[model samples]
Target: MASKQIQCEICFKEYAVGYCKTCGHIGDACVDIHNTGKVFQTHSVIMHEAVNVHEDDRENPKVIIRDASEERCKQHATERAIFLCTRHDTMICGRCLHSEHLSCGKEVVDLLREVGSIDCEKVNTMKSLLMEVKNEILLLKDDAENSKENFKTNADNCAQECIELGIKIKQRVDELTNVLIDEITKKHNENESTYSRITRTYNEKITWCENEERKIDQFVHNNMAGYLYLLSRKFDKGVSDVRSNLREIKHKHTFKRFEFKENRVILKCVFEDLEDVCEHQDEVTGSDDGSVNDVFEPTTEIQKTRRELTALSHKAKEYLDKSIKERLTVEAELKRTKADLNRVEKEIIDN
Candidate 1:
């Protein structure tokens, strides 16, 4: 008898059915695994009760160990199988009948001495299954061949899409840049027209003031009080006009300047978006969430910063543009002061 949990001498694996009566080697014990043969009997009831065992069935392989081609029980590797589990509807070993049926308790375990034989219908059904499996294997090989072609096609499409998308992005950026340039040009032309108009107005005012000064100089030999009184009202009105023009230049006639602000974060996000698209092509579908879209819709803090910068630039431009205007306004004020001084001198003479 073969002991439990011992290695099979033929396959060198743990567990076997029984030892040969002649050679004493377990599992398929013939001249192929051992050097002995010529067995007259089999030892099937070593630890199990002999059921349906007969003397006339000595040469048959059905009872196991009666012939050398006895198959091992696939369900029970370490024990003789004679029990049929009622719950699972499968054959199990002698140990399984006493133990649990898949740990469902021994109450559901049952034993039956069932027999199986291949008739014409059974043979035909098995043949059909074998053919179906063979055809499926051939179809699997066809899929393997088609996979290479499909991969190449998909790769080429991906490469073309990448290049086309890159070109579109470049064109989009160029179009946006041109729009900004056009805006700057339009503003520049408007500012130029305004500056030219202001300059002509200032020139006309200067001419009027110069004429008044010449008249006052010529009236020096006349009755001093009477001449000075006639000129004071006219002089005051002229000074008021010059002061109003200077105030307009200071408050309303400023040229709004535009500055190009570079957002590195936008460029960084684009690069990262591209990388993310490539990393998970199957997951990341392209949406309209480009970085340029947010550039026009600036955050409140960013808009505030831009406004502050523009204010600073306007101040700088004012300083640059008012260099000549400052001199003109000061000259007009000085003329008013001199006229007052002249009137005082006349008053002193009269006293």
Candidate 2:
């Protein structure tokens, strides 16, 4: 029976097993020296020299790989070759052509040479616009911070006013309460003294009437009607005087009520002509013309400015996030380009 042989994918050398006996690959072929042609030989020679870069250090295989890739990218980077190679998407330099792409037949273009001749007015305009946008962002951030600080200051002032006003109100309330108590005490004392004097006079008059009655009892038959008439008249006069004093005391009681006003808090009482004075200020600026307007709330322009500031603040935050992301992307690209440059330098030194 005859044995069937399998071929390797890269090197078409045939073998009679599951793997290539020469290269130890999972195919029956010599993969090292197969269908690479002359171009592959030149690339391999360049890669071998690049792989031995900084042989003193075993780490950083990327450094050697990058060196090889960059060298190859620069070498084969012509207009046609750049299209063929998926790594470097630019045209190859003159130095790269002779150094690495010695056997390659691919056509090349000089992108750098072309760019040097092209007009860049539009690019410059875009760069200027980008600068202006960046400056606007910075100014917006500064203004936002300033506005926040001003708001904090206003809030602090309001809080301070509330505290001071509260203290003044409590003080006024206490002072008025003390005065009311004093008036009530004075009026009560006067009423009490008047009632005590009237009661004593009543007792004295009754005693006098009793004494006269005793004397009249001794002469009962002769003087009874005359003494009774005199006693009645004197007692009626005393009762009238007592009623007049009681009315005076009632008037005084009404006077005590004058200290308190109807439907008003004691703290709000207007004894010494006190008033509350509060002030507020608003300032608005336009972004285009930098026009400023200072007005009270409820005005249409003021409301619009507030809304615009709020919207602008939100937009600023969103723009900041996007700018940060873009900056990071640009920085990453710059770092990759720098690394590519370093690799090319290292490869040039190696070659």
Candidate 3:
């Protein structure tokens, strides 16, 4: 008789489930272990315990392997394990579980197992989408490069314009300043000359008045001592005789007339019609002299000229302000262009 079944590893217990009780691994004699095939049977208990592994219940016992597919490994011998998602026109990995597409309904392993017989239309669509993204990115890169070059060109032009305008403004300021100084100087010189001429004329008039006063004093002295006595002695005569005597005395006067002309003087004296009646002869003579102006002050012409210069200076400043505003506008445009170029560049990099 054959020996009754006995537990080899477990003492005092028979093997009931056809698996070892010590390690929990299936027994070597079981149909489940023998019929499952080498691929599923060689896995350790650890792997079986982690997954819900089971036998296929078809007419024929087919061994089933879990989580085994090309998508999980480098099947194409490339770095990327690309799985085409045709519905979304994207590529994903075995770890991706996108729910957008019916084709992604299967697990990553089953999906890669059938990658060879995938729909041709989905593959074509994925390739078309990749090509479109590449083309768009290339166009955007080119546009960004062109924009940067254009901004550089515009900035250079603006810098040159600013330099040119600044030089022009400085030159204009210098020219205007010189003109104003020269005009003011000329006005000062003219005013000084006028003041000096007027002062000289007044002084000459004062000197003439002093000389006339001396002459009147001498005439009065002569009249009181001799002519007055003669007149008092002749008071017994008629008034008409006294008037005739006074007229005859005036006909022989020494200093008689002083005349003034423009910035000059003239003297005239008469001794009646007698040529040898007086000791001194009558004559007229004058001398012309002048001096440099001591001080200068602005006249009305100077004030008007200064005002006009101020107006011109204000106009120049206004033009400078306009030029500066134009420069600022150009700078603002350049800044905007730089920002646009940077943003476009960033977009390209991100893409």
Candidate 4:
């Protein structure tokens, strides 16, 4: 039968019977010999440089390895971070230990050890806080949506009330104006009738006096002295009667101009009061300071509804602020947890 053959991994030499005399056994012994040979090669290089370099120039291989293996401190960019300053919640280099963190009064732990010693309990606590904050935010969102709908409803109601009030005011103004116009028109018609009657009576009196004068003139012209003398007293009596009637007409039907003593001051005051009502409505409707009750003077159901809406708005604002605060806290904790998890993951990979 043919002997089994194996190859040395380090020397790449073929062997028989699971061993090679030149490179030792094929499995564990050859692996150890190869590793020891690498260590000697590294030691020889270090020793050769140590003989040629000054004591200060000879950097420790461990420090060089650590510096090469780890990330540098951000604050001290050229120095490798070796410790975690718990007080400042920062990774620091060896130089920072003797400088900024010397009297910081907190534990400074080895970064690798600290990463290895991460407590799952703290991560769970952070998760719990995050969940609570998320739930609170969701509740706040629901409350905000409800508040928005309620505010819209309140606004619609207030607008309807304003529109109704405006209509009523216009109607009242029209009623008052129409009543005054009607009264003035009636009075004007009566005054015109009285003027026409008096003018007609005065014209009749003038016509009768002219006819009597003409009769007197005809008697004088005809030289009928006896008849004229007899008719003189009648004529004078007729003239006197006509003059008396004229005087009576003048006294009874003198042209009296119509005047409307409308209560304009009272109307103006009503308008001013209406303006005040309008302004109060604006104040009530436009207020955002949760002062609806103060602005609207809750004497009616609409005002009471507005007050309730304002109270709801205030409550919504409070809840929103609380939710925001919780969200910020959760985000901060999540950031910290992520950084811790990353550190733990990196440590695991390194180990």
lDDT of 1 by residue, 1-351 (tens): 212244455566534445543323354443233433324334322312233545564333223323211323455555545555566776566566556565656644333323343367878999999999999889867865776677678789888888887898789889998999999999999899879878887888889889888777777756577777798878888799888997888688877787888799877866775664433234221237632212233223333344587798999999978987999899999999999999999999999
- Which stretches in model 1 have alpha-carbon errors above 4 Å? 1-150, 217-232, 277-351
Query: Candidate 2 residues 211-274, lDDT tens each?
Result: 7667657556676687766666786676677567567655543322235455565435453224
What 10-residue stretch in candidate 2 is worst by lDDT?
60-69
Model 1 TM: 0.34
In order of appearance, the predictions have TM-scores of 0.34, 0.36, 0.30, 0.54
Q: Identify the candidate with maximal TM-score.
A: 4
* Candidate 2 vs candidate 4, lDDT winner: 4
Query: Order of candidates by lDDT, top first?
Result: 4, 1, 2, 3
Q: Is candidate 1 or candidate 3 better by lDDT?
A: 1
| Superposition TM-score, candidate 2 onto the true structure | 0.36
Estimate every model's Cα lDDT from 0 to 1: 0.62, 0.55, 0.51, 0.66
Candidate 4 C-alpha lDDT tens digits along 27-120: 4444445447764343211100113333553442111112211555677755668888888888888898898888875588876655666589
Model 2 segments beyond 4 Å from truth?
1-136, 169-182, 209-280, 284-294, 297-351
Q: Candidate 2 at residue 291, lDDT?
A: 53
Clashing pairs in 4: none
